[model samples]
Target: MTIPKDKMLEMLHFLMLSRRFEEALTDLCRIEGKIPGMMILCTGQEAVGVGMVAALRPEDVIITNHRSHAHLLTKGADPKVLMAEIYGKRTGCNKGKSGTLHLALPEIGAPCTSTVVGAGPPIAVGRAFAQQYRNEPGITVCFVGDGATGEGSFHEALNLASLWRLPVIFVCENNRYAGAQRQEEHTRIENIADRAAGYRMPGVVVDGNDAMSVYTTALDARARAAAGEGPTLIECKTYRWRGHGESDPQLYQPKEEIAAWRALCPVARMRDAVRARGLISAEDLKAMEARVETLVQEAIRFAEESPYPEPHEALEDVYA
Candidate 1:
């Protein structure tokens, strides 16, 4: 599918935004010592977030994993509130209860961000089933990691989605490593999408680092699900520059491999691709980056200035 030039540029913007937001957040956690709780950033996996989110309709549901700031941001969450949530302030989306782990925006149909390995798939299946029952127009997109494939919930979710022909798009962000263990060491299969065959669902593997490729694949999957087709497993082979969390040591990762992936930076690649297409000039790219930088800084300042929730309001929005 030919994407509009403006939309392509917008995707590039979100890609830049996701990267810069995490960079700022990382600085806040490591250097400034302001952020609370364990922070996980999707620095190298911006393409999967921006591309897929761009492909979906606004009404569609999304369930994200632990590293989900990119997903929420690209899905149109307010940066100030999201950053404030990380800061555990009252102005946050979840009123600062979720922190960096389980960020959810139910008003936008992103009702869940499960940190449990492979938990997103099951929740996505349930949402898809509800959509199927009500004959909704959109599909559920579940973002999981390569590590999530090891969990039994992932298989069960796939099986149910297939059996009932639910409108769910299972996207596995295979970032080469599950925590510290390599994909080969933890799982026997070379590609995570191959597991879709067991449940009779279509599995499409694409370059997770390419925004256009991911968008195209996701667009097709969404179309299929909307047409009453079964779920599709889209394995996005990406790589994360940082460790699992803020406290992880990089002793297990090889310096050479990390350097090689860094060379194929998704944001840089998307910028170059758009530039080659004459969609954006270097000057415009710089201007866009400046705007994003300003936005991120403003978000951080807003979060820092925001107040934490009152002690008496702990159970205000809590559900059983």
Candidate 2:
């Protein structure tokens, strides 16, 4: 399916906005100490978030790991709410009860955030099973890191998702590292997508830095899921420009590697791609950036002014 130039530009702007927000958050975490001592960043993976979100309906669900601010923003969740939540404000999503590590926006079907590495896939598979059994058209998308795939639950979830043909898409943001360990050090497979063959499912690897490519691939996966073709495993070859978490020193990755990946920034690439079509002007791109900046500033102001959760509210929502 061909996307109109305008829509492509819009998607590019969204990717840019998500990237900007994440970049701002990294700064916020450092100077402002807004985030906890440790925070994982999704810096260079804007295309995966923007592209994947573009392919989903509002009612379709997304389940992701701790590094999900970009996904949340792409799904149209309020940045104010996100900032507030990060600040543990009562006005934030989940009443600010959950931190950056555990966000949930059921209104947009992003049920929850998992900080437990590979935990999200099974939860997403469960949601997929429920949707399929109820004959609902919605699909669940689960994200895991290259490191998470090493866990036992990753294989277990893959087996279940395939055996039942659950309407879910398993997306592995293979940034080539699980914390500080390079992916090659932990696995022998050339491509993470190749693992899908064991489950008898289709797996595709795409340039995760290309927004259109990621969107097209995710759209196809969702369509296949809706048509009862089960799940698809998508390995998005991307990189995170930041350390694994805010507290991490990141001495393992070479400086040259970071420089090389930074050159592939998804938002910048998408902007260039859209401009090359001659459908968008330089002024239009500037306007989009200005708007995103204003929105982010407002989000910061709102989060800064928002009230923290009441001291007595800690007893709530613990029934699990």
Candidate 3:
């Protein structure tokens, strides 16, 4: 798949933006301690989010996990509003209620996010089922971790999706760890995508650090789903650069493993790939970095300047 130079640059920009945004969030958490909820950084997993979302249409839906900042940004959610939501400000995407873990922006087709490990798949299944029923063309993409594969809901959702030929893409961003426990500790299977065979669906595994690879894989899955071919399980083999949450000590992972994955930084890989093809210049890459820095700073300012939600407003969006 030959991607245009302009599009490749755009993908690189999104990946860089996601990384910078998370870096800014980390700094904010360290300095001001203003972030209202747990901070889960997607520093190294930017490629999967940017590549997968880039393959989808504007109307396509995506359901995400706790580590969802990249997913939201890639789906075209406003960075300022998302930052405000993380800061628990009134002008946030969820009116300061959802926080970092649960970001919901219906206007952009990302209706909700879940902090629960395996909860997102079932919701994606429900949304895809609705699309099938209404004869809607849009498909649902569910982002899950390796841990999710162990849950009953994951199996149940896949069974239903396959049975009904629902237009859903089951994306397992297998980042090696489910919190502190490594994937090998809990599951016997070598690859999460292997489980997809049980549901009678096509299963594929790709180098998650490679953005173009991920994009092509997602594009293929999207085409199949749009053609009424049902759900596909795509397992992206990647690694997380940070601990599970802001407060985690991260004793489980060895320093060497972390260093090795960092060496394969997705952003750096994409930049090198583009530069090697003479698609982008070093000056252009530096300029893009500067722009991303400015954008992140602006989002931080917006979040800080926004007001907190009023006490009475908490009950406003609730339902029985």
Model 2 weakest lDDT span, ten residues long = 31-40
Between 2 and 3, whose lDDT is larger?
3
Q: Which tens-of-lDDT digit does each residue in 1-320 have in candidate 1?
A: 68899889989999999999999988889855588889898989899999999899998999998889888888998888899999999999999788889898998878999998988999999999999999989789999999999999999999999999999999999899899899999999998999999999999999999999999999999999999988999999899899998789878889898899999999999998999899988888889999999989999999988988999889787688
Worst 10 residues of 3 by lDDT: 29-38
TM-score of 2: 0.96
- State the lDDT at 285 in candidate 2: 74
Rank ordering of all candidates by lDDT, starting from the highest = 3, 1, 2
Candidate 2 lDDT (Cα, whole model)? 0.87
Q: Residue 19 deviation, candidate 2, in Å? A: 1.3
- lDDT (Cα, tens digit) per residue for candidate 3, span 1-320: 79888779988989999999998888788765688668898889999989999899988999999989888898998899999999999999999889998999999999989988899999999999899899998999999999888899999999999999999999999899998889889898989999999999999999999999999999999999988999999999999999999888889989999999999999999989999999977888899999999888889899999999989998996789
Provide TM-scores for the models: 0.98, 0.96, 0.98
Better of 2 and 3 by TM-score: 3
